[model samples]
Target chain A: MSFLSINSIAHIISAIIGTGAATAEEILYFKDIRDGKIDEAEARHLRITYKIMHWSLIILVLTGFGILAGVRIKYGGTKTFYSPVLWAKYTIVLVLLANAVLIAARKMPMKWAGSLSLTSWYAAFALGRITEKTREIKWLADFLSKFNFVELYLITMVCYILAVAIVAIILNYLKKIIIKKQ
Target chain B: MSVLLQFSLISHIFLGLLGIILFYAVLMVLFKPIDFKRIKFLRRVSLLGLISFLSSWILGGYYYVVYYGNIVKPLIKKSAYPWAHSIFMEAKEHIFLFLPFAALVAVLIFYILGEELEQKQAIKKTVIILSSLIVILGAIMALTGIIISGAARLR
Candidate 1:
């Protein structure tokens, strides 16, 4: 395999690990915080989960930069680097990082940040996969070829907002069900 | 690009990255409970972030005005990746203009608030938010720099 392929694989793996760890952390936190109260042991477990997530993030970022550098070195001035999809992916990744920071600081509303985290991670992952596969998929390439990036970005934001609303409603319903069971 | 211009550009990117990393460090530290020792370390890190950001502003500004506009911009414009210049670079440059101010605010907050930051919830939150913004913008700028550099390779 070429150097780029190796880096790409590492990048993808890191992303998967990071996303999985984040998901696990979120689940653990939610499950542990019964009746909006977390005991010391549960809080410690959550902290450990966060630490694992943080390491995964560091690996993800390092491998991501590696892939980017490899691409630049191999392709020189190719349009791949300037693809609107690539830009959108980068923007989503930034949002993910920002959400992580806010979540750490307890500044963001939990439900919104959780939804944003999931949306940003999955969106970035999907975009990356699509960009990689576009070369082999004629219709996908053609569709992306004609799409305006700004419009696509705005559409993505609208979708994420709607997704957050749906998630909030579900969580509320689940909370009520759990309370009723108690 | 001339050797000096290249040096400036590389240094500019490096300093900007350093500033962003230090800002992240500040954020991590801020997220924890602040004590006398941690506050001292936070002060040092914040000052370093301020210096790195200011230096990057000078180096990047010099390169942008002197080399990028005159030399690199035209090359990328003629290349296959003009939007890298028209869109990403344009946004990067404008958003980067905010970093120095944000860094300054962070430094001033640290200087004025000192240990009192532990007690001043409102001011502490403002500093955290501003620091986080700086990190986000810096990360975007770093990524945009890569796109711009790739575009410049067409020449």
Candidate 2:
């Protein structure tokens, strides 16, 4: 396979692993702590999940940069590189990194951090997929193309924040139900 | 750009990233209880972070004005990714100005407060908030740098 193809495969694999690990972490942590108590085993499980997510994130970043560099070198700059969707994805990834740090420091509440982490990973993953398929959807391409960088970013963030809020509420409700069941 | 200028740009980015990482270390340290040993270590790291930020500012500013403005900026502005210049670069350059000052404050807090930080909740919170801001801003700057580099490739 070509360099770009190899890089693309690696990038996709990293994203899948990273986002999957994040989702698993959220679910496992919430499920175990339904009664609002984290036993040693549950804590250990969460830690392992977090380690997976973190390592996957490292791979994702490295491969993502490799893919970006490869594309620029091969294509000499495509509109995909300049897309606001890609920029927004980058911003969300940074937020995820920062959130991870805060979560490590025990500065942010776990639920909030979990919500943000999952939201960011899924958003970035979705955007990456959409950018790949943009050429196949002319209207979608045209629509995204009209948005300036700031407008596109702001809209994406507002949407992501709303999604996080809704997810958090649903998780909270689920936690209550699980607790009641026990 | 010249080879030396390229080296400067690379070093500038490297140091900026290092400074941000160190600031994150400072935040992690401050979040917990403050002991004298940790305080001393935090002070040293904060100083290093400040130095790195200042050094990066000098090198990157030199490159931005000397080479980028005259050469890379025009090319990027003409490329398909002009917003990479008009939006991201503009934001990155302006946001970068806050970093050195934030680093300075972080260094000053650790230097002046030391073990007293454990008892001073308000000041401790201020330090954490500032460090957090530095990390966030630094991350944004790094991503913007990538966009700018990508845009430059079009030329």
The TM-score obtained by model 1 is 0.75
lDDT of 2 by residue, A1-182 (tens): 86568878988998999899989988897688777699999989988988887777766765676676566556655666667778878878878888877776777886687789888899899989988888799998888889787898789888988988988788777777887887
How well is each residue in A67-122 modelled by candidate 1, as lDDT tens digits?
Answer: 66566545555667666777777777767767777777788887677667766667
Candidate 1 CAPRI category: acceptable
Off by over 4 Å in 2: A1-14, A34-36, A51-78, A97-112, A135-159, B1-11, B36-48, B58-62, B76-97, B111-113, B143-155
Tens-place lDDT per residue, model 2, B1-155, is: 56667657766866887787788778767778899889998999999999999998998989888888998899899877799999998888788999999888788878887899999999998888899899888877877778788788643
What DockQ does every candidate get?
0.32, 0.23
Q: Clashing residue pairs, candidate 1?
A: none
- Count of clashes in candidate 2: 0
